[model samples]
Target chain A: MTAALPDTKVLSPGNPPLSPARIVVLGQDTPFRLDSGVELGGFRIAYQTYGTLNADRTNAVLVCHALTGDHYVAEKHPVTGKPGWWNLMVGPGKPIDTDRYFVICSNVIGSCMGSEGPKELNLVTGKPWALDFPVITIADMVRAQRLLVEYLGVDQLFCVIGGSMGGMQVLQWAVSYPDKVYCCLPIATAARHSAQNIAFHEVGRQAIMADPEWCGGDYLNKGTKPTKGLSVARMAAHITYLSEAALHRKFGRNLQDRKAVTFGFDADFQVESYLRHQGISFVERFDANSYLYITRAMDYFDLAADHGGVLANAFQVTGPDGKRTGTPVRFCLVSFSSDWLFPTSESRAVVHALNSVAANVSFVEITTDKGHDAFLLDEPEFYQVVRGFVDGNAERRGLAARVG
Target chain B: MAGHETNGHIRPDLERIVEWVQPGARVLDVGCGDGELLHALVRRKQVDGRGLELSMDGVRCSVGHGLPVIQGDADTDLKDYPSDGFDYVILSQTLQATRRPREVLEHLVRIGRYAIISLPNFGYWRVRMELLLRGRMPVTDRLGHQWYETPNIHFCTIRDFITLCDDAGISIERSVILGAGERPLPHPAASARANWLGEQGLFLLRRN
Candidate 1:
């Protein structure tokens, strides 16, 4: 790392966070064309499941993972060996309640961690796809997921839920396959990527490209790795996931294991060391090329632009003034007050769009100092909202509890 | 009447508003507080209900009980809804809390086929007596806050509201002014006694 970035180790983690037990290739029957107009003959989708599908198969809940997330929603992470990222919300007797409904979470097509992405080897050339991988968007990721869900013989998903980029996928699922999704929860997300967000992603992308070891996205072929670049990119992106208040509350310019500053190119601050560990650990389970591709995918997400500049039209309704046939899907949008990355206003815009059609929708902005990561952490109000919404939707769908 | 509770159980203000909502009607309740009225209407009439509350506590409570509630301001968020969008747009005891009660009232009638609004009367005998006798802002069960920190702005008398309806071309389908026990008074809103006797006014209106 340069003097600008903190450094650490990456070659220690075992299993690399890729669970080989659940991998399925889709698009075998026909070619799959993406939003970028690129066609893929076939690709793999890595996934994990919880609970059991009812006899009618209408009890499936599809959980979409965010940019760095994988299919491990309620299980042990194969990478960090820590608990699943969403364990607080999606476990037995929890908000999502594995005891009741069948839940499926998949790594998006554009990401790594066993998913078919830029880091994977091309079947034709037998080399890592790297930059050669076809550019995929959020809709493309949902399309691949739709194929996988179809392959599983499920006609409708009971609920589609996620946060951040996962939330974007959730919106895409509701819009793309309207009939397939019965309910959706898009949390801490926007209908379109903001310019400021795109700028942050651009910085991360440029850092990886600037690294000499990146080698034009062919580091794997040359028996080299872009560890420094990927770590730096992770370091930069991680800061945006939090707020200034959260940063101050966490580190607050506290010195790191010393009385005073060493005045050298070392981590003199606790925050720097914490970020260093975060960046260092992230690179071990992630691929640099995959980071480039996923950030690009997020930068291109604009649900309104695809539907003639009216965000409401994207949800099968015209503008707020238009006559409404109403959407079949019930939606619950959520946001955190401290999340500057995807602020409460973005979620409200989606809520207003839904309200325009008088669609069945609910929205709540939970007050917290924890920032965007609050969704993954323990927030009682957010938890209660999820539980109530999920259970309420279940009650309306006429799905009875198999137990009790 | 099967899901209905005794009138003595709920607050007097919501009990009257809840009685006006018909079964299976499409409804939007603004400033719904903790959604007590919507909750009662949903349980009793099974109305296809939605609520807009301004406070996070209110939203959390409403949503936790399986109600479709969103956090929104009555003055600003009302414009986003389409005209004739709901069967009934309810603004119960919340009009005075708004910045533009007139524009908000106009939006309510425009968006819904019918609009039901209730407001605490400022020209009530107690308020007049409180000013003439003590020379201080009145604080009663209806107007529960002090003047310094009260959300009750645009406090209007029944006569003032009737004149507002006439000025805005809104047709009042029914107007009920409740007295000390929240009992519906025999005197109508246009009657001279309404300004002196009634504690609050509930109006059912439509666009002219």
Candidate 2:
């Protein structure tokens, strides 16, 4: 391991202790080779596990976090004191039931929240990597996850699940290591980022970079935080996560704590106040440079490009007869009705590709006005579909149900 | 005629249709309501089965049963599917509800080596009797709605379907007519007497 920075506190304030978070440090001998061809001498991964690994370790399920998500999937986030991001969907007797399966969640490499990211010390320079950190891809994130899974002494995962960027990692896992994953559930995600999505990400990146306090990604070294820029970026991106219908139903044109509009450009409207709150609260626990790196990773994701131009080529698994017998990995894809970001058509395209390869796959387009964020909400139908898929796949895998 | 025993009840038409489907075949059940036939095929025939349903609730119910089903319109979505995609394509009791029955039939033949179709016969004696005697649209157990509220807009008889198949250059591999109570007719389905007496028609077809 390299020397720790003397003033690590200068990079990020309110740094929580790493007690609840299980940290794994990979040394130079087992360096994590990134898609950008640059690798760190040493780095650490912050993860959290729920449920106990069965005696045979066959019940392990790895849950990948989305762009802004961390390892706090089924517990209160240490930094925000808010319930876990997916606590509604994962818990005892829940869809991803802890009583039946072992669950593991890890903060991706290009993220904050104790994971090795732009805010972490570079070890060689004894300073935060910041802009100097190499650009990573979705594949890189999955590769890092594979390392973590291997570290846990699990030969194969019973299931790998995620939504949005986390969903991309699930796809990458199926493509990169087909035999390792028994079941994959990718919700509201695509094989590649759409042009419109990339455009939106670009706007967020520019907002962070344009901030005067950013100081060429050396804000940490200069003892300045790009709160305004990061907040603006979060506010802009949050709008895309929701639908116009949802926004209308949620806030509409209602005034915020006033009888009439102030007309002074302050948060007079409820929607404006809501966006402002979302932005301000986002900057509290997130790092600006990490956002830039992670968004770039999502933009570079195009699984089909890696395996020729045909999307079906990504799922080609040869059998003993030397014929394309399709992949053994069973997949369940889901999309939301009002999600313009990743619409139902995108999920259908993925299903079509899987069909072309004759792969075992299922698809569901949930009717909801909740947009892309519906996966994160308490949608009963989504829960039912997930529970059915997981339980059915578990039975097929001969996993005995755990008695209470 | 042995009835197709399902939950102790005999559905001869569905049983006759199931008999034509080869074991371990790849099947796509278009307009599969609640996926009863597809599930039975998967369980009994050991065939790899998929389904396309029009109603959201039906899709949900089928998926809840662990069936691979997508909510899609048979009229428009069928054209997008690749040709020769499955060994068998089935459209059960949903032909009259489709906007373009002939087009859907063409797609079924193109997408699958064999197509199985089942429909309620509008020319059955009881239906004709209700129309002629009461001077109104028939409302029987099979056609269970008033004309204004009925979903069966393109209802056709066994004779009308045979003529349509002939015009479209589709060859009927086999045909079976069921009585008013879903019992198989004793005579051949092609005979004119059977068409007037039979309440339902099941046909297995292939492209010429």
lDDT (Cα, tens digit) per residue for candidate 2, span B147-167: 999888899989999999999
Candidate 1: residue pairs that collide: none
Q: Please give the range of 10 consecutive residues that has the lowest summed lDDT in model 1 chain A.
A: A1-10
Q: Model 1 over residues A79-187: C-alpha lDDT tens digits?
A: 7888888988876678787667877778889788877998888898998898999998999999988877766667899999999999999999988888889998999
Cα lDDT tens digits, model 1, B1-208, are 2122342366676777777877899999999888788878887788988999899898988787778899999888988888887999999988888999999999999989999999999989999999999999999888989999999878899999999999999999988899998988899789989889999999899999
Residue B164 miss distance in model 1 (angstroms): 0.7
Best by TM-score: 1
lDDT of 1: 0.85
Give each prediction's DockQ, rounded to 2 decimals: 0.72, 0.40
**Which regions of candidate 2 fall more than 4 Å away from where they truly are?**
A1-19, A27-31, B1-12, B15-24, B79-85, B131-135, B164-171, B206-208
Where does model 2 sit among the CAPRI classes? Answer: acceptable
Q: Worst 10-residue stretch by lDDT in candidate 1 chain B?
A: B1-10
